[model samples]
Target chain A: MIRQANAVDFWRGLALVMIFVNHIPGNYYGRFTHASYSISDSADLFVFLAGWALRHLVGTPERQPPTWYLVLRLGGRAVTLYAAQIMITMIALAMLASVAILRDNPLLLEWHNAAAVFHDPIPTHVGLAAITHQLGYFDILPLYVVLMVMAPGIAIVDRFAPNLLLPLSLLIYGITLAVPISIPTWPVDGQWFFNPLAWQLVFVLGFVMARPTGIGGVVRQHIVPIRIVALPILIGFVFVMRYGWWPDPTWFPQPRLFFLFDKTFVTPPRVIQFLALVAVISVAYPTIQRYGPRLVDFLSMLGRNSLYVFCVGSVLSLAGQILRYLYRGDIVIDTVVVIFGIAMMAVTAWLPEWRERVKGRPAPKLAPSS
Target chain B: MPAPFSRDCQVGSTATASESPLPNVAAALRDKRKLKILAIGASPSAGRRSARGGHTGETKDILQQAIRGLDVEMINRGVSGELAAQAAIRIRNEVALHEPELVLWQVGTNDALIYVPLGELEQTIVETLRWLKERKVDVVLVGLQYVDRMAQDDHYRLVRELIRKIAAQENVIAVRRYEAQRLLAQAADSGGGLVPDEFQRSETGYVCLSQYLARAITLGVFGGNLRPRELQNLPPRPQN
Candidate 1:
């Protein structure tokens, strides 16, 4: 089934690699990240893929059992991600603490927002577990959990009132952006970096588009027209990014929030650029797949096992940061770290299949017997 | 131009160059002897981690101990990787919500690390400080930390210089975190530890940072108001 949708998986895999590279913050490799050239980064790609994956996982209402069964399954996934967030957060804190203690750098404890764990462990730990607090890079999962919890509802709406969902999702997104509301952080006061309210539109778009429904059908049917609009938008963003030029936020009669290229609430420019990116890239995938079979297969493999690889990649990224701190990693060292980390992720991606073979679950084919 | 002072400056004894910006603090000091200070910036000022950096902790806890016997209500809103621009947007709301007399802003490090254009960084400082000044909020700009890797970093130097320059131009207190930390390291090296180690710059580093800030606040707020005491002679007590 995933093989049929290898492009999604391949893109997700590409997103994973990008996420890993971008997570290092100040690393030399980060300069090459897509965010430098575009408003949307791998975060948009990853979230969109998540929505696509949800559609794939639950094909249609008829294909799934009961609504309760769907809710239970989706709820179970949310719980798993929640547990993973806590586990990874603890490991990251320990990693920071270990580095701080071993290297005699108290600064490490304060860096990456780990100061709460050392300074005020009780409330910070409680906040982290409650999903009210999150470390710098380990934030997306809590958001993923919320989206998963919403999936059953989305599925129900998709099955029954398909036309209602997108507009409703957009309505909520638009109003939130206008009102400028976001979830607040607890134990420490602030707000979530990626506001789920605005981001859900992209996720919902990904979901709605997978099916040849109203808006999705129209867009898919008018590919040429969309591509014609998408190409120039894509090219224009290249200039915007490279030149650091943005539409003036001070436009009269329009709220500054509407135009600013803000990440917290996925602004219009970001959403347009991201959609354009998806359209343009999706249009070319077929050509690339035929020409570069090996590349597609490699990325698709990583994509197929995204959850495992993402968790490992996130952990590995934190480790990479610590190692960079210890070594003061130069460009050469940063490159080596990235290559080695991606290789480890590749091995991790393959390990499940390797184990399945070792257990004789899916024995290798006997060539001579045929 | 006044050089940024280390922790040893007889801070509280001398009036700050300007009047206090925090009317609430001034009012409380005059009426109830309870000064509620809301320090918001990165982790050192006391908030959670922002997107890029994970600087976290109650830098306020350290300050509470540093400024004991002076009913100081220290509220921290430090978010690591929080730029001055972002803080400026959030600050007005914070001022409305918490209503502190003074704001201690630790800035420039995240901007430097991300290679945000110097002009943008300067604009952020200028705009944020100008807004604070208009609102009569007494602000002390805490400069960036000293990292061995940053010595050769031109961008880092520029950010540090900008913070200092802004403070000088605006007649605001600028706590020289880099110089103070470097001084601590030098002192430690002279005392036999060649490297000065991590705690000197981390735990002790934050402790010193908070002390420097707390002392700056005391000097800024209680200069002529409080009975004179050589702040350098009074070491900040750790309120564990």
Candidate 2:
């Protein structure tokens, strides 16, 4: 089993809390979230950590798990995410419906892309299950489902040809940007909010790096130099974004697809920025764990049960939105919502750990170790 | 809920509604029973609920019901903090993708808040209006939402006048939301405060704005001083 309270859990748990606050469209706390200052926000953290967690959850390349069992395990996680997404969507629609009916205002039905669910449920439910249609602020899980489903393949590649995985993933990502392709949404007709094709690169990087050998190993060996390069990029992006000054797109020559800062493609700047952040943070995580506040343990507990916590956080944030709308967003309202939401998430995390504790099982991990 | 109509604050409420700015929208409605309307820009049209609970969708639903026997499909792509300059560039792609018959843009608030370059904001609006005209897409400019305190804010007043000037120069129907909202405050009980409480969106205010917008559309489409039928059965806010 994995270490119960570590930096991975700490960071992931923090990301969940941030994601919850950020999901609320106009919450007062939004300005304080990482998105305000950084190009890549908690979403990047969540995805990257998911990749990092995959290594710990499953086996590394040296002692790979049985192929069939590994496939089944990854498949199960995917199915769970798929179901969680569908459930949250249905519940969010129900929440919107209750508000609309209770207030006698049909307009709430149209907000947040919930119109499809209300106007036509059967086909839209199909779209929701198929992961083709997603509501605003309720997207990332589908990407999680996709990444988990693809994890076995990544693990397999990491086992057989570790070098091929990143190259292949990058090749696909690069091709998508050059071709301007993405997974499309349904009923509404737009691209998926979190395009998986490009995002899988980060996921693969997380998986490969967690291995003792590979790009991650290289980085661990030369982290000082990597941090030296990364530190400047982070400071530069922070300055540029803070000043509302972005590099002009026209300055790039032809085939500038790779250079653009567009979010959909997970372009160079965002990826590089994220990588730089990771390089610096990874170097400092051990020291942080040694001298961190008591809050770190509290957050790590939430991180240990991330899936359940994330699902609960998503629904709570929606409720927070409704509460914000009804009561009006003041400092008090926002603070109360965030505290209550985090508490709810913490409770959700505790229940699972408590359940497994009473049962005397080794804290029900994601997959059974062979 | 037949709220008293405010003739004084109604900007384009007169007959003709300024040469039927959304001709193609009406034409499309008449020809095929379908019309696509794109709602863009900030706060109001983005279908956001204010502290008072006013919804942009109230306007869409009211227009559909008032026009009677027509399907109005609305695509709301409202990013709350989007500057007019950013929206101007983005709208080109939105138009290319959706090809909406009419575009209802609610802007100025974010620009006012951000203190964007006044000349840049104006140029963007002028260029966007010209582009829409060339594309034969009708547009209605939903100006800055009114907050009583905003009247004293220099940038807010300038943006409001700039929007008014743009609407006149381009000959488009500018829904004077601020004026109507101020009228709403005036029409409310005096103890309720003479402002629309900018923090919360009011359902009554949403209804009022929707009704006014529907009336403006009806006037534009049929060139008559008509109003949406009284939707009498609406629920009031429960006492907290």
Candidate 3:
């Protein structure tokens, strides 16, 4: 039976909300709320849950579908998502260009130029750079696609020959560390905004743990102990960082050993921090599952259709910007407009559920227990 | 060891100092009150060399010896190849550590070489100087010398004017090294048969130039107690 964990859905929904809240300018509540968690930490947990949900949806062992069928299904979703990304980029570029021309400002004109835009505002540059080559933060979509395509090959090894996944993942992770892999930053900049080669290890680890095997069973059983150890370790790491234990390399030459744990490029310390966060979440999962009500259900609904929600949310954000441009006065008014935009997105996200409920089809059980 | 000089050796007459092996040059140069002077900047003040040989002059030692007997301790805290922005980043740690009474800032050269936009460079320098001034650290901003072969064009002039404007607006002492170099070249021309061509053209040109400028800056900061002969006779530049 294809089942989803309500707990996972609730958390994923919460993360999506946090992501949206963080994206809005002047909205610091989300950051403060998740101050204990790094974005990568939340992202790692979300990707892991994604793998777990995939396993549940497709079934494991006895009820497993054929490898080819699984590949086709995952690959199709990836392609569809990638195509959607391209369409969004084209639209965004057109909007930016139109805005620049309408403003008739030299600075805005310079911003439209790829080289100048890349130098001045990197985020927008990365989005535009995606058109020619994958050079934006959205490179994550392509990376996810690659992983999905390789998941079948991984699934085969995972099912019959589970022991191979660890050594192979470790090898890939080691290579990722040893090799200096960087994606180009665009028109003028050469450095990668985010290096996927290093980041892929997190996804691979998620994939390896997703299988209903010995490691997963161990994780399920030892949740409390993992949390007990992880919480202190994470706290200590944060304390060390805050106190400036790592010497500024400009003042003194830093040793190569320190680079092993440097998180500027998703180093091992980041990986440890991510795992620690997951351990805490796993311990809290059961509680969230029990107490989560309508409010949690709303978020889980948003999480279930995250890609669709993100696309709609992005367009709503554009609308919010347009409104602000027209009525630029009170901070209270701006905040209200942002809230209205979020509400609009929320309504759009729940439309399908409302339709299904009207048809008396039990709302298709959006939250599943794995 | 015996006191370097006897209390009686404080005689005004030079005749009293002929017998001492190490005459009281320090006593002669010492003012009653010590002035807390802090010398800082990029590599030029740090007394380090860059890859381009543009910063070959060891101005630090010249400034050090020029103020040696004066009631001032000149601290050199220059890092090699640092732009103004990098200097701004480290100012809190570096300049604040010294608690300097007076800061000699010689930067902006590397920023030009590294192709940092002039606007950013100006902002960084202005903010850094403002930060120091707010902290009550008196600043003496040294303009870049036109030594880089690549910077020999009109671009160097533009950079020099930018530094001048920053110095003026901040109400800091502007040490015009480019003007000083031009004056030195003019002095060499005017000295005709007295100053040898070798002193102006040979590798010693930078040594003499730095020593001369250091003496001028020292005299400007303190009074005329520093002697030109004393600065010229200091140890030779260390060769690798």
Candidate 4:
């Protein structure tokens, strides 16, 4: 069956790749792919795409599963991803420890201890700390799990009680702003490693967009015009931000405009930027669907198995960081190492599909029978 | 010192005879030739005062005035409570704008206080010096010498060594303020220091050494009248 790839899937897949590319330091293509243009906007885009993709894959109002079943499925996925992340983090820590031991540098050893990753003569250090003092910085699994658990309730409200979901989400978002909450950072009381209060807005937004009837469908229809206007506006804004055309005040502690849409908390600037990105991508949907056959297929593979891909990609990047520190020579070698790392991630993503083909397991149908 | 002053006095007297007495006297006494010397330091250089009275006396100004007939214009740009890192950030925009002939860098106290890693501090200093040198500007590094309490600390030793290393590598003048302060402290103990009373009253006070060192640095850079008594104790230099 020749299936039309979902527009949200394409965008979300593209965003995930961008996130990976941006995470890698000094990656040449990072400028184009990274949300560094405006981090808040980039985050919004990721959240919006996530919402769209979830709706597209999980089923809309017309073909909705029971609330309890939906909850179970999402919760299970979240738990699986969390376990996988923990394993990946352990592997990364092990590699870092090996590097430190080999170097004979106490400074490197100190870094591991400071980060709470060092465990020698007893491996229980990582496990013991994982229970009490979670590795917040390197771990997004907990936040993702919380979002997933909340998704079913959001979905139910969207499907059965549309008006209530919109206003309730908006109200919650407003309350969040008024009484800002933060998830505490490890090793520090106030420091939030993942500031859930700020991040929840993104998840809630995704839940709302999962319904097929509202803005998502409207956006998907007018994708072309949105793209034409959005691409130029984004470009112009970047130019103004970079150059002194619209100068940030030197006297001010933080830029006035940046304050409005700061990523430190999910602010209004991010909301606009995300909407703009969505509009532009919606317009380009037809073209992306038509021309980039091979690229789309490869990216779709990444999108379909995002959790596995992300875990593997993170481990590979960590290894690359260790290698770069060890070699400390030519830029060319570093570039080659990064490329190898990316290739490894791509292969790992493709592995499951290859396995499915060998077992003769059919690809899951997009629109399940009612 | 006697010849230069006497020659200038005689010239003033001769000029008053020929020209209108009022205008000629005004011109001779104007002494308005501003010496453009930039004194850049952290808190200590900003804090020094005269031992005698209420008027705060910066050592840079005194040394500049001592060499007044040389037409020296001195600008004191010492900011209080700044480490080497912060100084580096502001240097390109603020400090270098004066187009100073000699930059008297007196910092590193705050760096020690904040416990800035030796490597990072060294990098900041090296980068700062390179930036100045690239513009063909001369730099005279003032070594960080705190009181007896802090002098024995490892951080102070690191800063001292780093300063010496940077000075030698960059081929810049290294003012050994630490050693100079040590000598002054010793002199105060022997009742022969510059501000003996201040030293005697507050044994750990920076008043005497900072003033003397600042004056010595200013004079050394600007060719002033006040002799650097600290430099006299050292071995004689090979005459070029």
Per-prediction DockQ, in order? 0.19, 0.07, 0.02, 0.02
What candidate 4 gets wrong by more than 4 Å, as runs, is A1-6, A40-45, A109-114, A119-137, A220-233, A244-261, A360-370, B1-240
Interface RMSD of 4: 17.7
Worst 10 residues of 2 chain B by lDDT: B231-240
Q: Candidate 1, DockQ to 2 decimals?
A: 0.19
Model 1 stretches with alpha carbons more than 4 Å out: A1-5, A247-255, A357-370, B1-41, B44-78, B81-105, B108-140, B145-172, B178-240
Comparing 2 with 3 on TM-score, the higher-scoring candidate is: 2
Of 2 and 4, the candidate ahead on TM-score is 2
* CA lDDT, candidate 1, residue B34: 60
Model 3: residues with Cα > 4 Å off, grouped in runs: A1-5, A35-41, A106-139, A185-192, A240-264, A315-334, A355-370, B1-240
**Per-residue accuracy of model 4 over B70-156 as CA lDDT, tens digit each:** 444444444333467655644543343345555657667546643557898899899988877665456666666534555566766
Candidates in order have lDDT scores of 0.70, 0.71, 0.50, 0.51
TM-score of chain B of each: 0.72, 0.78, 0.59, 0.64
Sort candidate 3 into its docking category.
incorrect
Q: Positional deviation of A30 in candidate 3, in angstroms?
A: 4.2
- Per residue, candidate 4 scores C-alpha lDDT tens digits across A245-303 of 43222222322322343443565555655656555556666687689876777666666
lDDT of 4 at A60: 56
lDDT string for model 2 (A1-370, tens) is: 3356878889998899999998775567989987778888899888988998888766765666788888999999999998899888889889988986776544455456565555545666677778876776788999999999899888788767878989999998988877767686654344676789999988877877776777878978887888999999988888866884764454465455576665556777888898888887777667777788577788899999998999899999989877765664567888999999999999998898877766854655687678
Q: How well does candidate 4 reproduce the true complex, by DockQ? A: 0.02
Q: What is the interface RMSD of each candidate, in Å?
A: 7.4, 10.3, 16.7, 17.7
